[model samples]
Target: MPDSKLRLPPEAVKKQHSLVWRIILYFALSSITLSVIVGMVLATWNYHRQTEAFQSRLDYIEAGYTESLGSSLWFYDETQIHTQVKGIMNLEDISYVRVTDNLNLDIETGTRPHHQDIKTIELVYKNKPLGNLQVAFDRQAVLTEASQTAIMMIIAQLASLLLLTSLLVFVVHRLITSRIRDMALEVNERIDSNSSEALSIPESAVHDEIDILIHAFNTLSEKMNNELKQKTRAQQQLKQVNSELEDRVEERTQSLQTTIDELNHALKALNKTQGKLIEAEKLSALGGMVAGISHEINTPLGLCITIHSYIDDHYQQLKSGFDSGQITKQDFSDFVAIMDESLGIMDKNLQRAAHLIKSFKQVSEDQTGEHIRDFSVKDYLNEILETLSPKFKKTRHQVHIDCSEHMRMSTYPGAISQVMTNLLMNSLIHGFENKEQGNINILIAEEKGNAVIRYSDDGKGLNEEAKQKIFDPFYTTKRGQGGTGLGMHLVYNIVNQRLQGDITIEKDCGCEGACFRLIIPKKLDVSDS
Candidate 1:
């Protein structure tokens, strides 16, 4: 019995001690359940009765007040109609009352209920049909009454249940629980002292189940005592084996922890390396733009210089002719014309150089910092294209921008510039690889409070494999021929993370080229950035 008790689940032992309470609780729960079922049935019946009474009240109102209401409405007596509807509002469960005539005169009182318990009664005056009267009934009153009755019923049933449970607890404790509790206490004391004494049975008791239980317990106690003596020796041996195993497990755990720490360190290093690579890619693009802009600026600056030299030489000639007193009207006029033409050419070249410089400066600043500012989308795209004009000047690739002038956004323009730059560069380098001529079209529009950009190039489009892995870092078709493969990946990151937007390639775009679609919010939240 002791071994079996040890093997029994903890809940079984708890139930043994709480046997009396469990029985009382079971009895109370069953009684409460039966009471609740009866209460619900009574409440349902009362609710139906109340509903019928409410309907009868509506019928009474129609029979009693319909004629007076119609007569008041027919005479166009607004005061009388209002008075009659107000009286109707005083009835029980009547939430709202409204009277309307054929002349579109509407008189209503009280607030309408949310539930649709409305009744419409047609008004008739002297055998002629007038407008109708609408009465809205409140069903909450019926529910409230039913709830009150059920609550009272529950209170009465609970009182009866408590009385019965108390009586049952007293009977069960005297008859059964007291003996069981004594046995439990004796067993606990013996187990704590490692003794196997038999439980004491009542001397006056008959040889019933309780006495039989005591005999069985005594037999089990003797056998358990013998088993305990044998188990004591085996437990001592197990302790030594367990001690050795614990040391081996501790050593293995330490080795595993060391490997985990090394793996974590390696992962951190790898992530750091990846970040550095992404930064290097951005810097490389910036450096290329710097080189391109510098080369572009030289041409206009060179023109300006040549025009200045020509103007100076002509001025010297004009001064010499005037000093020698041999300057003709035609000569003077011709020198004026030459000076005018040279100055105009110089001014034009200088302005061209200045415009180029301004565009480069803005693009460079935006690329270096993530600043939020309001900018016209069309104007910004123009500025970006101007900075990239040097790349397209030699190619037959015509770039077109289609966007609304009023469309604007407040976001990280640097990220936008980077994305545009990468896309244009990709088109020029890979899309238009060996082709002499290609067309790139950019269409920008506002869609659902977001800026949508569709950029397509009429160059060699991507295949299934290339399209699938196009935005993956370090993936490029031109791996050996100077393709860093980070352009599109950078664009993807900028659009998704920085701009809080999405970009997708239009798979079945009718054009025989790659079409990339970008959807970015017009106004970015600071927290999102």
Candidate 2:
């Protein structure tokens, strides 16, 4: 039946949120409170105004009655008094009128019967007219007036309160909360997106603490991004610096290695010079020995030469004699057989001496030739073995060259020549030193598009300790008597560091003797030199 009895939604009962709604709420509440206070004050004031006004009207009537009574001995008839009271009742602004004879104590109304308060007033007036006016006004009009004034006061107080509350709410929202909400929403949006861009707050919104917060956040985000970029750039710069440092270290190491190589080369030249001196001394000694031995052999050689000459001179004579029957058949045959045997021995000695000199001369000459050519590898390398044939023969070492024919390429012929020469000498002097018959196999073939060269020996397989240092310069298993200890070191340098080819010691069951596998490019680039 009433709006107050109806249920309200949760939101309606709950606190308001928007600035405008809160402003409405604030005004409504303030207006209600002020109206309540004003209603109470007006209620009190209206009650007092009615009380004083009614009291004054009662006094004015009592005074008029007292004056009109005069000095009569109180003998007014009840009928006459009632008529005079009826006259007073007709006056304007008066609600009721009554008269009570002061002496007889009799009350009369203006002809109409009334309720019993009149009897009580008659007793009081009969004793004395010196009491209160014995009449009560209707009072309905005063009650109505008070009620209407209270209602109007409440409405006016409420209206003024509402206006004042609204003004305050508007001022607070504009000055503070509106700007705060704007800034808060901006920050929340940026945080949700994880963006680095500065928030653009309104210039009007920029005020007090909220403005400070916006600027600080923008600066913080900008600083963080800049710092991260700077860190990334610094890391890149660090990597570049490290790379440059590494390159510098490598260059320094290369320069140092070049110096060491130059020194080694100088040492090799010195060794060669010493070898040449030794050879020259040996040659001089050999010449002296040859001269001295020639004198000792001169008589015999002359005898042999003279005898052979005589034989040559007489061979036809002897044959003619035999034919002419100047000698017997048995004697001629015996002389011919003995002379032939002596001449053959003399011819073999002269040929053996010549061959010895040629073999030594070849070895010396080979060491001197460093020229490179693109000769057939098989032919070029085989010739090297052929030249070393005498040395192999003395040591009784077997050698093989398995390079394919027609497999030609441009390379340093001198390097390969020296490499092969040294390897053979190494095997002869050290590999087969204790063995009666040593076997060395060299294979050069193409495998999987790369030139493959392998070296292996069956004499005494390389010792494990020696194998490890086999490529180190001046490291050798061979003693000075038979080796210069640079063979494998030189081979390693030529095959790997110089030729840009890879070389590895092949896996052996230890039965492959010392096998080395070299994977060489088919076309050797000479730029490494």
Candidate number with greatest TM-score: 1
Candidate 2 colliding pairs: 105-126
- Relative to the true structure, how large is the alpha-carbon lDDT of every model? 0.86, 0.63
TM-scores for all candidates: the values are 0.54, 0.36
For residues 156-197, what per-residue lDDT tens digits would candidate 2 score against the true structure?
A: 877677677668777767765566555555666676688777
Q: How many residue pairs clash in each candidate at the backbone level? A: 0, 1
lDDT of 1 by residue, 1-529 (tens): 1223343336446565477888987898899999898888878988999888878988999899999988987788888888888888888878889888888798877777664677889999999999899998777778888878987898899999999888888877766776666667677778778789778756335675656777889989888888888889889988998999999999999999999999999999988987888898899888888888898889989988888898889889889999999889998899889988988888888898899889889989999987899998888888888888888898888989999888889999889999999999999988898999989999998889899999999889999998899999889888898777878898999999999999999988778888999999999999867
Worst 10 residues of 1 by lDDT: 1-10
Where's the lowest-lDDT run of ten residues in candidate 2?
116-125
Q: Which stretches of candidate 1 lie over 4 Å from their true place?
A: 1-255
